[model samples]
Target: MQVLMRPWGAMHYRIDGPEDGLPVVFANSLGTDLRLWDAVLPLLPGIRAIRYDKRGHGLSDSGGPVSIADLAEDAAALIEATGGPAVFVGLSIGGMIGQALAARRPELLRALVLSNTAPRMGAPEIWAARIAAVRAGGVASIADAVMERWFAPPFRTTPALHPWRNMLARCDAQGYIAACEAIAAADLTEAAASLRLPALVIAGDQDGSSPPDLVRGTADLIPGADFHVIPGAGHLPCVETPAAWAALLAPFLQDHAR
Candidate 1:
């Protein structure tokens, strides 16, 4: 556990693998901390990986207006601070950050992985409704609803349920709403189409938030991106089916590693 203090707020992060290995920076989904990557990390061999909590998630502070660019800058700063440029692995909104960052700062990347995310999320009205809900009822108001969309019926009752449920309930309302706003405002299709880096896109079969076709569409936006869909997994394949997700990711990393 470490903290990277930014002028706006501090971010919690962890770095693993060998110093000399290829560096891969991971950004997690909304309502999750860096722990989002726990199951997937050990499966990848010989790669230096970095994972961080976005502001208001996990141990990071909740301050500043949330924008996709702001989130990208947060990741860029963390990567530059920890170990320079690396492949960026991001999930959900993290994938959105990867797209925005890759467009804004292409030089700071080796390869890119976007998991269970899309070019754009819901409409502005949907985000507005979410912001209103959080403001009226706090993060707890949407915890179960968010979880419902995150995992399927079977996995929802597993031991894994509690931590994520709590993680959502405990998130700072302001920060969570801010993230919702960023998702509402961001559209990365054009930017993703412009990327020249090696890219991989992973989708979970049962993901309602970003369905397999949506994820595939995102992959199609990139010239040579590889796409994989995890069977029996919901939104967070890293949690529901890490091995399968790793099977898809590790090879891509190997193919693109410098």
Candidate 2:
């Protein structure tokens, strides 16, 4: 349970593997914490895996107002603190952060992995409606809908689904809304297009939030980005099908390890 005290607030983070191993920084999705990568980390050995609870998530502080750039700055500071020029893997809004980070501080990253996300997630109207719902009834009000988008039908029926639902329900509403505000205002299409680095774009075939075509389109934006789709998975493939996710990620990590 390590914490980095940033100028804004405290950030909860953890580092695994050897001190001198290749650094792989993982930025989690909107509602999930560092534990989002728990199942995927063990599958890829011999590398330092750095994961943190983003502002407004997990044990991190919920500061007032945030944007993709603000989140990217936090990521940059974390990477510098832990030592960087590492491979960065980001999911959902984390992917958006990766886009912003690569554009802002290209030297901080060796490669980029964008998973189940897009440069622009949803329309402002849609985010506004979601914000209204959360304000009206809290995150629990949308937990069921979020779960459906997060997991495939088969996984939804299993008891394993309950914990994830609870995770979403228990998240700070103010933080959740702040993230929604960031997502609403973010449109990284131009930044993603200008990127010139080793990049991999991944999508869960059944991802309702960022569909395969949308994720693939993001891949197309970057020059020479490898794109792949994980079958039978939803928004969070690394969580839903970690082995398959690691199989795709291990080789990328190997190729770019510094």
Candidate 3:
């Protein structure tokens, strides 16, 4: 329930692990809040972790329409709040923000991890169609289809599906639409390819949204970045395979520890 009251608006955030430990910040996917990292957090209790909802998602207040640059600035503000030169881990749109942030404020990040995301999600037409759908029918219009794309077959049948559905259903339509617009406007190929910091790019083999090759292409953009794929997991690997996700992350964090 903690919040960081920025001049633009308040951002909901939570901190775990010790303040003196290696700082690890997490930015979640679109349609999800900080809780997206719940399962993964317990496994990484050794490193200091910070999680936040972007302006629109989770418990944070919305700022009407926004762009990818706006989202990246918000992330920069939060990392600056932490005095972070720490590792930044982001998923989906969160990953897009990380790419934008690294390019915008490279000094704030010691390393980066982009999971189940892309430099650009879909084409302008695709995003426009999605935005039109949400505005017309609300978040419920796309929740089921999004769920299908976000999780693997086994996860779709699990009880976890209930809460995720509820989370999506509860999100503000304007906020969801705003984030979708941001995703649409984002084009980070140049920014991602220019990064000089330690970076790890991860993907779920079964992810329908940002498939492994797409994620790999993003990794390829960063000169020396590492890439890994989690089998049997979809876009949200931290959910379907938390332990495996953590296993892949632990060494990368250590290698890039500040």
User: Using alpha carbons, what is the TM-score of model 1?
Assistant: 0.96
Error of 1 at 249 (Å): 0.8
Q: lDDT tens digits, residues 113-205, model 2?
A: 999988999899999999999999999999999998999999999998998999999999999999999999999999999999999999999
Clashing pairs in 1: none
Worst 10 residues of 1 by lDDT: 56-65
Which has the greatest lDDT? Answer: 2
Better of 2 and 3 by TM-score: 2
| Candidate 3 residue-wise lDDT, 66-156, digit = tens | 8888888888888788768879999999999999999989998999999998898988898899889988999888999899989998999
Summed backbone clashes in each candidate are 0, 0, 0
Model 2 residue runs over 4 Å out of place are none
lDDT of each: 0.89, 0.94, 0.89
Write candidate 1's Cα lDDT for 1-258 as tens digits.
688999887788888999999899999998888888889889998999888889878889986578898999999999889876798999999999999999999989988999999889888998898899899999898888888889978999889799988988888888898899889999888988999889999998889788899999999999988888888989999998989999999988898786
Instruction: Please estimate how well model 1 matches the true structure, expressed as its whole-model Cα lDDT.
Output: 0.89
Candidate 3 residue pairs in clash (backbone atoms < 3 Å)? none
Q: How are the candidates ranked when ordered by TM-score, highest leading? A: 2, 3, 1
Candidate 1 vs candidate 3: which has greater TM-score? 3
